[model samples]
Target: MLLKSPWSPRLAGVEGTLCDRLVASLSEDILSGTLSGGDRLPAHRELAWSLGIGTGSVTKAYAVLERQGLIRGIKGRGTFVSVGSARRDALIDLSTNTLPLMLTDKLLSRTLSAISRRIDSDHVNLHPPAVGHDEHRRLLARWLGRQCVEACPEQLILTGSGQQALWLAFDILCGGRGIIVTERIGYSGALALARHRGHPLCAIGMDVEGMCPEDLDRELRDHDSNGRRRLVYVTPTVQNPTTRTMGAARRQAIVDICRRHATPIVEDGVYTLGNDPSLPPLVHLWPEGVFHVSSLSKSLSNGLRLGVLLAPPQGIAQARSALEAIPMTSSPVDYALLEEWVSNGVADSLRDSLRGEALRRNNLARDILKDRPLLTDDSAFHLWWPMPHARAEALAASALERGVSVTAPNAVRTDPEDDESGIRLCLGGPSRAEVERGLSVLAQLTSDG
Candidate 1:
């Protein structure tokens, strides 16, 4: 008699069927500690034959497990159980996650074609200069100039990634003893960087429009009395954690304030692309005082690690000098690949696809969280939901118990005293089915009286 299988029918293909069973079996084994951490699994063909399935099925199963973090596949070596699989029992990773919607095989094929064309011309590994290849820089600068018409290509500088650009800006502009004003709840990366550099972080208040102008003024005034200058950092478009976008009026007010005080605003517009085109960047409004940072990671593949920094005309030389002091140059191969993608319109296609996927996930969240109070912008990739009964950590822990991972507010806060009770759920990180199931699990946990 054939053995009864506990796998789901939703996974259909031969490989999917085999993978489903293997994942089910492996999940149980891992949880039971039978397949302990660092234990290697049998070879693909070996496992397939033993399980009475095709080798392709075994491969697919392994891929599923790898994506789920149950296993880690070494390039040459065999696959082994992940170290933290057991410890991840009660953690839902709704934090620091992203998913690509437009990474279609067609787009991949086109990108590969473009890359192959470049490789055929023998332009793969040649490092052009510290800044970047002139062609790539011009292309990117042209694109940015069109996006934010106020700034020209002369003001833009290329970096390896958005985080790197931010670091460079901090180092060049807000050196020793300066105050960096940020939102009470903001991107933790900026906060961590500030703390690491030993700069004082003045947490300012924010409203639906983003940083309150009055609070910004107050912080500036307070810092002025202390004989220190202040630099402001903000993510005006689709602000992380809160998923709130700053409007035009607020943008004008911020620009006006920066101009008046000569305060430099490092505006993170990483997520601004692939959204509604009408949302103008602050850099466009306050070109003299605003420093703009953006990246292609969220829209395209994160592996590229390409970022563009647009500084004021006067600050460009200083910014480039600071960047050279740290990471002098980014990988040429990555830049070439990114430039090829951008030239072929593959990047834009991917952005559109990712945006649509984010919308669908947001819709799913709306349906599941209909009764619950959640903060989300239609254009953002993540949502912020407050748990009524449990603290953010408790809720995250509870969700993790059900095999879902999420990030609590505390994980993203610079100060422990900051609000410790909300969670940021990334709609882009997991597969759609996985997100649906995960959100269902979360809804159950949060709904429990």
Candidate 2:
């Protein structure tokens, strides 16, 4: 006996190919509560027959939805809607890992006004240089210098964001032909980029110091034995989710391992601005072998959409040329605004203010979950609560039911089978009151253990 599925997607007027349109319709329904969490979905063949679409399209749509964390499938029980699927506006929304909006209307208006008055015909008419203008790079280099990163403007390639910089580094360094090594738990953006590019990835185990140098050496040695190319990507300072910062010795050791293996590194320093910058980044240790990436989104304002890729002397031309080939979304106006902010000390002011706000949120979380263990520091925008994978997912579902959103475990863990799962609570996206409320909910839930 065949039972009809309760949910059916309306694809009329939805734009895209068959598969894309199907995905869009289903996503809209799921997010809008037309289709709900835990509702059983029709099997591919069943849905295809009902919708008059090919089974392949249905399969593809399901894959897309699953990737977006909107749906899930159990081998025998069949596919079902994911409980994590909810309209973002209805929740406290702690999943987004970005600095909260601290920019006042007055400051932004002043900055834009200043930029508009300075816009010249030549600046507005001409296309930006492939690697950004010298003045823009110079200001960015000066900003990096303040953070203890020594680099010249010539070696810097301006990017739209930290994610784009990572994309460029992975594309050029690996060329989708080699292995990408990173920590077991890493930034979701980088991991997704590697997977999307079809670059083979391996995760190194970590200790209290962050990426284990000994494990990295062995992995590189094994891969090198096969004449394979490998690139190491790491986030040593305030590592994503875990919020672990490596010391000077640990950084040197990891750098030494990669240098010994003759493998290049793409170091992510986006979070370094908010942390203690006394410890030098890996690029400073081995500038010729590391591609350092940083951006102003975390510190100043995400609206700026400005980032820089500090390449080695030998790789400067190649990185620049590669970036030039891709169509850039940033405009001359954006660069001018960044340049103005950096020059007038507005950038530093915003960062200091955001840092204070983040610290306050962190303290609140600490007070609420004082007895519970956390993988967080006072400087980071997010905190991690480690638990079993099943428990983590359960906690997320529980929090969602209470109207407090959190990052799903699948977004953070590299292996689904790994027992150690973590739930990342982003404190920077929501207001201080909302963050406190969310933390209290989590505290109550965890206390029920």
Candidate 3:
């Protein structure tokens, strides 16, 4: 909801006081939560037409709002409200891939303590099925179905982590030797695995919205459809390295392309924090060919090492068989704990808290790096900036020297020849003050050198 009502900005009195009235209306809406933290307001021209007031009023109101930290104007992008400041910690680290602890840690500790006391007598089956054929699969499926995916037990294969799920997806979908196409800038771990196994990665082009469907179609066409095409991997939501999310239409287009080509798609939701019912996973669109891999690592605790791979019945069975050989299977204790969390709504509660924290963190990042055009999604724990490859390296080094750590473009680039630079600033690890300090250093370096 951008604005509750058109011409809702209270217009009282004559031309001279229009700006003041407009500001009051906006302020009231913001305080009432009708206009949320990241909600974009109507453009000045459009609002003027609706309210029959001068555009100057809107502009003036925006200026005053910006100074008060109530709102901010992103160039080219619209104006959004500020969620206020973040809490500060000791050292600032922008390189972490993990999230801040929400309620999961406290819940986990309490659960573990209870489990330890009960572990004495009858808890013999400490090793659950690594393939997740039992309770874990059923519970997880029901929990995940909340995302509008509607997964079944037969279609879910449990793994130690999302990376493990990816490994299984690659083996089942690609047979270890075809072609694995992914976004040009993607998850470094997956890219590293592709390189290690000698899989020729066809890096597709991406923009702020995410992997371009036209570019993906082009890349798919160039390769021998029957011989080379294996799996097309993507992090559609909260995409790594660049915090870009594909809109519903873009995802549909990509799904249509893959479905037509008979290509198996690996959909990574490793870092996706939101379970927005509107943007369902690609697997929901085409369960037969789309393999959705997600984990509790981002939303819950990383140390739990609990991840699930959902595909069609046949596809998940094939992947599940490969899981038998992997040493890092979910322990029965942890599996049972995860099952309890899902069944009792603990996971959902924790996820909700994490989502709120992420929003707060994103707001902090926006306020800190607002001057530079940084890529960010509202619920993401990270921010990205596009720069020259060389400049990215220099800035990262400078940031590190100044006690702020960051990951630059080369780390996530799929091509060795790619010289385009970018930086991924993680906002989840540090406190508000620490992140502000780190961002200040990076911003100064970027602006100066």
Q: Which candidate is the best by lDDT?
A: 2
User: In candidate 3, which residue pairs get closer than 3 Å at backbone N, Cα or C atoms, i.e. clash?
Assistant: 87-432, 88-432, 88-433, 389-421
Q: What's each prediction's TM-score?
A: 0.75, 0.83, 0.74
Q: Residue-wise lDDT of candidate 2 within 1-449, one digit each (tens)?
A: 54456786556332125665576567656766777788888999988888899999899879867866888998978898898785543456677688889878998899889988886557568777878877778878988888778889999888888889888888778786668888888777777677768877788898887899999999987655354477999998999878888999999999999999889999999986555666889998998999999987876777878878999878877776786789443667777777787779887777788778878888899899888788887778988887888888678767755667677676665554567777888898888888888888898988865
> Residue 72 of candidate 2: its Cα lDDT?
95
lDDT tens digits, residues 58-96, model 3?
A: 898777566646678888777777665111223356776
Separately for all candidates shown, the number of backbone clashes (residues 3 or more apart, or on different chains) is: 11, 0, 4
For candidate 3, the clash count comes to: 4
Give me the candidate number with maximum TM-score: 2
Which runs in model 3 stand beyond 4 Å of their true positions?
1-91, 103-106, 113-127
The Cα error of candidate 3 at residue 133, in Å, is 4.2
Error of 1 at 330 (Å): 3.2
- CA-only RMSD, every prediction: 11.4, 5.8, 19.4
Q: Looking at candidate 1, what is the lDDT of residue 136?
A: 60
Candidate with more favorable, higher TM-score: 2 or 3: 2
Worst 10 residues of 3 by lDDT: 84-93
